[model samples]
Target: MTNNVVIPSRCWCGKGILTYVSKTEENPYRRFFRCEIGLKKKKEQHLFKWVDEALLDEIQRMHE
Candidate 1:
């Protein structure tokens, strides 16, 4: 069974590429990524967090 996974993607800010930082167990160990550029800007710059599934549900509902 594969344990570690690498997600190749860019940040929302279009600043720098993001990499998997850590994993959480809120819902079966979800992977989290963060923007390197945004991290250097501020501690709470809103770039170092995982995309929550709840947000996706809300977005899908909005389009329907």
Candidate 2:
């Protein structure tokens, strides 16, 4: 999928985004943005983006 990262300010559910570090073995210590409500209800569509990917998108935008 194309990178549409833009440092999301909010989720479609109208809640503020939260930054959290991953504690799983697959993605240990990786930071990501997520909607608080989505964390409670795992089986729902919500905003979730990687901090590093978002920053990379920002840098790419600057060059373009």
Separate clash counts for every candidate: 0, 0
Error of 1 at 25 (Å): 6.9
RMSD in order of candidates: 10.0, 1.7
Clashing pairs in model 2? none
Each model's TM-score?
A: 0.35, 0.90
Alpha carbon RMSD to native, model 2: 1.7
lDDT value for model 2 = 0.92
- Per-model C-alpha lDDT, please? 0.52, 0.92
Task: Evaluate residue 34 in candidate 1 and report its C-alpha lDDT on the 0 to 100 scale.
Answer: 69
lDDT of 1 by residue, 1-64 (tens): 2222223255556666564545445535654456777667775463454546434544665676
Badly placed stretches (over 4 Å) of model 1 are 1-14, 21-28, 40-44, 52-63
